[model samples]
Target: MDYQPDGQTPYQNTHSQNMALASLILGTLALLTCGCIYFAVVCASLGIIFALLSKGGSLTMNTSGKIGLVLSSLGLAFTLLLYIGLFLYVLKTYGGFDGFMQESLNFYGVDSIEELYQMMGVPY
Candidate 1:
């Protein structure tokens, strides 16, 4: 029952607007959690999906949707780069995945993977 100043019914695009808002929120979360690579990836992916969905049948997206898409994309890229860099660093410093595992187990005073799991209270 909303009307414009000219006494005409206001055009309502509620669904699209809601989708755009969700995209924005998720995009922000993705950016904030970029350091947590896995979480950032999940949030960024969902944000991108919502941003695209907000476009509906239109060829163009609203401002919020566009911003969300950009933010989410950047977040995802940053997360990937961060993880890749960490992996390379670990490989160089530890000699390999096995060396890294050995170091971790030694640091935790665990003789084997099963012992580590038991120490962490995880059922082996």
Candidate 2:
């Protein structure tokens, strides 16, 4: 008897709706900041969390939440790949970790990591 002829549910899950919107916004931010690995990871992680929470114990998510989840996942993947590529490039350019360390020390005008740390009063 409470049903309306329009056939749509009278009550809306406002909390879920808000969460889905937040997820979408955060996912967009994650994608936009993909070049900054740390910032992108944080945004992507929060986006994924918001999307999952938007499900609200339901087995299925609304469309916005699903899109947010996908975008955040892609952002995380891209961040990981960027870091891996950077590491590989560093290894190839420097010949190894030792070479990289040596170059770093030279750049700092120090003979060794311990010397650099001592110069900076880091208790080596």
Candidate 3:
């Protein structure tokens, strides 16, 4: 039976706000799980979005949501970059780059990278 002078009722209740905060907490926990980088990233992104939206919608923004957003985003970015770097390292270690360079050189009738190195006058 809460009333406002403007005859408008608040759209959110304490329970709903608490639930939202809990959701944010749970999402954050899920993000921290091992091998769940993608999931964590997604959860964090959603949490941030939800938190911002809740703030705009006149819902209280909890501290947990803020922390979760920051942690999750960082975790996601770090994990994503790490995964990309790992894949790149694997590709490079497996001779992917060297093979491609060798094929290109063969097309140009070069016997070795050393020949190109010599032509470029670059020391080994």
The best candidate by TM-score is: 1
lDDT of 3 by residue, 49-98 (tens): 65565454444556665665565566566667767787688677656777
TM-score of each: 0.78, 0.71, 0.48
39-105 per-residue lDDT for model 2 (tens digits)? 9999999999999999986678999999999889888888888889989998999998898989999
Q: Looking at model 1, which ten-residue stretch has the lowest summed lDDT?
A: 7-16
Model 1 earns a TM-score of 0.78
lDDT digits (tens) for residues 9-107 of candidate 1:
785443388888888988999989999978899999999999999998767899999999998998898889988999999999999899999999999
Scanning candidate 3 in windows of ten residues, the lowest lDDT window is: 10-19
Of the two candidates 1 and 3, the one with more favorable lDDT, higher being better, is 1
Q: Each candidate's lDDT (Cα)?
A: 0.89, 0.87, 0.62
In angstroms, the error of model 3 at 5 is: 16
| Candidate 2 wrong stretches, greater than 4 Å | 1-15, 104-124
* Off by more than 4 A, model 1: 1-15, 117-124
Model 2 clashing residue pairs (backbone): none
- Residue 49 lDDT in candidate 2: 96
